[model samples]
Target: MKLPTDIQILEKIYKAHKNDFEQYENDNSIRDNKIFVRVDLLKIAQELKVDKDIVFGRLYYHLNHKFNYQNAGNSHVKLFINRGDYGKDEKGHEINFPYMTSILAGMQYERRKYQMATIIAIISLAVSTISVTISVFL
Candidate 1:
């Protein structure tokens, strides 16, 4: 039998724990702070009749690369699954671009700062070498 796709596996897990997942999502105490639904991975695995490792590997890969979902904590134990479009606008477009943009901008700023520091270090070295040579000649 063919293995299920990552999305299919996730769907199965959601279906198996529909009530828990929905309750978790609807609970302001949980959803107000975090955009994740905590679920027991071992239970989901047993319900789907799949190995826990396979489920974890697929979930991790999809979360990081495809942005279909985000997960926290260990899949072998429990996991918090957050939808990619959790905070999207009504039209399904991301409404929080400023937050993500600020993050990218911060990363770029750090990169530029490092580049400038390296340039300054090289120039300082060059000046120090020149001064040493002049002292030797004097």
Candidate 2:
């Protein structure tokens, strides 16, 4: 079977790895990564017309949990916003282009497991595997 193209792979990776990327943003060691989260929340606020404060409050809590930050206070949020890694590489290279690169990687990994499930379902004449994919992804 043919493998997915880079774009397709990235799309899948984006879905699966979005959480990790979010954690990356709140991690001071990776502060440059914060832009992705910042813009993402900004877009949500713009589109939903939600108050920025509320949106930030919610995002802050989520970020704190995901990043394992012991302190879930304004200071931590501020630090993450101001000094967290912005998804940069060791060479100070920002991986901003592949916003969904991590998700795509995860999708590729899941694809094999999914394929196996498909084969199993086909052999067993069970439709659950296809349904599972559709339900989870769609």
Candidate 3:
């Protein structure tokens, strides 16, 4: 398919990872949808002077988390799947999934922050309970 310039680049990247992306399809359509996200993130990373390797690493994390790591993770592929065209294979339905590194990083960082907050809240609650119990005894 004749994808836009940006999408063409993205399609190339997706095709590059044919082994990992084969489950989606041997087709390069996955690259088309993911290109927008990768380019946008790359632009932002360039603006921020972030290393491309770092960005790519995070992107890989997103892909693994979305596809391989099923437990305790959201369906990251669903968004891209909704954006692009997917067809059924000999097995079943397949969709193109794009993993944005920045987003994946942010999601992990946010999850950590939430876990920390929950821990703090639990500690505070326990301290309050202990304080109340001591006061009652006193």
Candidate 4:
């Protein structure tokens, strides 16, 4: 099995939750023409299985051109796993850079992901595994 790269994982997650990113841009875009999506760095860090700083650095480094803002990427997109983290970090640092204001601004602007089917499938898989384990052991 081949492991997915950090960028690949990010792109996959971004595509899944693209609507949320678009919504963020729609609600928070400073200009009508320019679109700067507000991404959850903490989430990306969790999905990448690495430090959030690494993901942030990678995105910033790649998208350095015309990207003079904060806490946003204008070039590449990535996955976010920290469902709990939206606008603030553990230390309560201001997550929003310029337009993404408020503590829950990130989550507030974005729409919820439709993962009910996946969750149900996972539950079914777990139940089958548990049944097999019980039959084998007992």
Candidate 5:
């Protein structure tokens, strides 16, 4: 049997989980603005009678070109198709998934590093103030 196109697969998964998407949208508990659709690699592979890796490879090939893929734990993957829809820069060009993911990950790492440095500086200043106070008392 011929394999389905990436768009076809995405449509099938979305159709199958329409209720889930709607429920998620209606869920006020979720504060995150980003929405994603999850697809179970194993389930798709079984439905298509193809190897799981092959299915994943096909998805990677198509999605990497436009959408970011996040391994959502277990055998499922999250699709961030909106990333492609939104323009990243002034030029209105969408960055590919691999590069965009890496850039975002790097930004996150830098933010964490800045936070850690701020914490350490605060602690160091506190220690120095305590030492000066003790010296003054002595």
Candidate 6:
């Protein structure tokens, strides 16, 4: 019933909702799996018994270009240009599904940045604690 923090997690919750029901007639494919497109956010919230804002925030975080809403109407307004990762345009630009993986990866590049930072912090903390202990003893 708890709110999902990230898009990938939210997607999992959506799938769970889809599975419990029997009326899903269409699907949105992710890799080999067909993630159903028939999403009912209100129903999902009711089923999970979570707050609407939390679920909505999760949905908005993803569908709104990963919170890239700086410009009020920056995204494609026309329906044809809003094909997303589902089709090819006139220029043969085959859009691929960049969800789950790409959004999380991005061009940030530093994959293990947090792990390295944590190691450095722990080392510094230990060294400082040792220095303080020595000064106290002295």
Instruction: Provide the overall lDDT of each model, using Cα atoms, as 2-decimal numbers.
Output: 0.50, 0.44, 0.44, 0.46, 0.53, 0.44
What is the Cα-based TM-score of model 6? 0.40
Backbone steric clashes in candidate 1, count: 0
Best by lDDT: 5
Q: Clashing pairs in model 4?
A: 10-78, 10-79, 43-80, 43-81
How do the residues 28-96 of candidate 2 rate in per-residue lDDT, one tens digit apiece? 575544434333434344444555344444434443244322355543322123124334312321223
TM-score of 4: 0.35
- Segments in model 1 whose C-alpha atoms lie over 4 Å from true places: 24-34, 68-138
Worst 10 residues of 4 by lDDT: 91-100
Mind sharing the TM-score for model 1?
0.39
Work out the TM-score per prediction.
Answer: 0.39, 0.27, 0.36, 0.35, 0.40, 0.40
User: Which consecutive 10 residues in model 2 have the weakest lDDT in total?
Assistant: 88-97
Q: Kindly list the per-residue Cα lDDT of model 6 for residues 1-138, writing each as its tens digit.
A: 455445444444435544533333343233222322333445556765776555554554444454333347665321011223313322311111233234445423343686689899999999999999999999
lDDT of 1: 0.50
At residue 131, candidate 6 shows an lDDT of 100
| lDDT winner between candidates 1 and 5 | 5
Query: What are the runs in model 4 whose C-alpha is more than 4 Å off?
Result: 1-6, 9-13, 24-34, 63-138
Candidate 2 lDDT at 69 equals 29
The residue-by-residue lDDT of candidate 1 on 38-111, one tens digit each, is 44555666766777656555655543344432347533321333334333312221112222233335556777
What is the per-residue lDDT of model 3 for residues 35-101, given as tens digits with 9 covering 90 to 100? 3322233443354456544434443444434544333556333323222221221222222434433
User: Which model is ahead, 1 or 4, in terms of lDDT?
Assistant: 1
